[model samples]
Target: MATAGPTPFDPAAEFDRQVRTLTELGYPKLSGLAPERFAALLEPLRATALTAVAGEAAGEYDPESGRVPFVLVVTRELAPIEETMSRTTLHGGKLPGFVDRSFEPGALERFVATPEARHPGRHAYLILEVERGEEFCGSVPLDAMATIAGRGRSLLTIEEGVALITHFPQVLVKNKCFSLGGSRSGDRRVPAIWISQKAPKLGWCWEGNPHTWLGMASAGDRRATAGSSGS
Candidate 1:
């Protein structure tokens, strides 16, 4: 059989849908609140949604190799009522509830710096906060796979990462790290796409919007290839 074509990925549309869901569920309106306050409300919700979609936390990091390494932290709680409320409201009852956690800012910076230090490819980072005080942050180290292209390791890139996200919208929750991106308005649009995983998916009590911030960039090799062709 012929392979299927790649699915269309619309970060803005997905974000709008989630915001609408949250509005319907009675959560505070994201647009009206201050940036910091809005982020605070969404963090927990993002954690719950991620856990619901990606069972167990699967992450990658190297503590000894770089000045800063990417980290993924997962937390669980007995009850996640707040998480559930956020999920149900945002996803229109399609997601489940989760425990609570908070996403540290700047977590992505650490993740990005790690791979860039050792590899020659470009990369981007996305942070997804879940409903249950949990967080799931990821880094798309573009083109770094070339370093291990023949080493038998699975090559990962930002495009592939975005594709994975397109299929599983729930990797937004889980916490544990420093804050790289400051809480600001322009920061919201830093990435081509951004996702905020909400409650009704995971039940946990906590304030702040647990969300996934998606950042994008061209792979180093791809950029170099394009530059060479143009010359």
Candidate 2:
């Protein structure tokens, strides 16, 4: 018997492959929260405005079990407001505007700095866990993973993390979205990839290509046998 050589990595091609796989797996419809709904979810941070963004359909197939997981692209924008009663109450003093003029860019960082900020604004992805006969799990932010892990809170399993990236590849790709400085000339867009169980224990890592090597982690060895759908 002869072993096959590793396949060459091509970011663009891998992205197209994942998107195509998602579509074929039956993730045809994409939905997102309206601006009002987004705002409601971000109500705690009244100074922050949430704008739901457009998303694409995605799906992944498990070759081992012949199962397919599907998902939708969902995004939200946060704009910092200068004043809010909530901020005044939390900080014990009226602080400056939530939006920092000196920062120039990186809205997500600004969101995390505020005393009441629950999440990082830029390049941050939130995952909502769904389990049968259970209330919807609270939103989990990707940037806060280390903190959560440090605190020894087993709030999320590796499988959940994998599911998150599978459903929202945009989160990984959009990390550097603002690096272009508003210049649209000859800019290159990163491709997205979906990590299946056959790929690695890192759940699913995608950024342009499956081999691009942006980051990796052990999501653990948790498996879903059947009737699992990305909702």
Candidate 3:
């Protein structure tokens, strides 16, 4: 069986698509900005989009490591980053884009520079998929990962982490760690902050999002007190 070659990319179209996504993510404060200003803000992104990176699998999934180690973050919510990196045909796109390229070995360094580039906020967890071995799901900040790498504690390089992210497998939305709704209405929606919750296994699902700011504050205080007293 002959395999198909990579598709071509259109820079003009891909630039427009990315701008639209940023709008949905509530960026640029468009209402107050002049058209020229808004367009100017996007010039760098537009320029970056001119080049396309093809997506390819980069890391080996360890059969022995059942835990997400950091996380098995679902691909959808975390996908905008990948999409911003390459056309959907590459892997994470819902629609096609102009570029037919994949991330090269050092691609993460560039992807991190995109204007709206952000690391997805996901809980640290221990996942038991039953069919698969234990998957450790947690993430330290990028700086933390860098620090670890610099210390030579991890055989995995920062570039390797970027490769893992770029070519992460299509994941299932396994669980929710936070939610919000109006007091009178039962409308659950994404919240602004996930807040820290450390626990064994599924932290988000078990601890849940605290309902009130005061409640969260109290928890923080208690944790602080415990740390101080124990010391």
Best by TM-score: 3
**Cα distance off (Å), candidate 3, residue 197:** 15
For model 1, residues 1-231, the per-residue Cα lDDT tens digits are 352333333333333445444445333432355545544544443433343324223433221111111111111121122332233222123544332233244322222222321222122122222111112223332222232233332222222223222223333322321112111122331222233354322111111333333222122121111122100
lDDT of 3 by residue, 140-202 (tens): 223322333344322121111222222222211123211111000112211111222221010
TM-score of every candidate:
0.22, 0.21, 0.26
How many pairs of residues in model 2 come into backbone collision?
Answer: 4
lDDT of 3 at 125: 9
C-alpha displacement of 44 in model 2, angstroms?
A: 29
lDDT of each candidate versus the true structure: 0.26, 0.24, 0.24
Those runs of model 3 whose alpha carbons end farther than 4 Å from true positions after fitting are: 1-12, 24-26, 52-172, 175-231
Q: How would you encode candidate 2's per-residue C-alpha lDDT over 100-191 as one tens digit per residue?
A: 23323543222211121122233122222211101111212233233333543223222232333343322222111111001111222211
Give every collision pair in model 2.
Answer: 22-59, 108-121, 108-122, 191-208
Rate residue 72 of model 3 by lDDT: 18
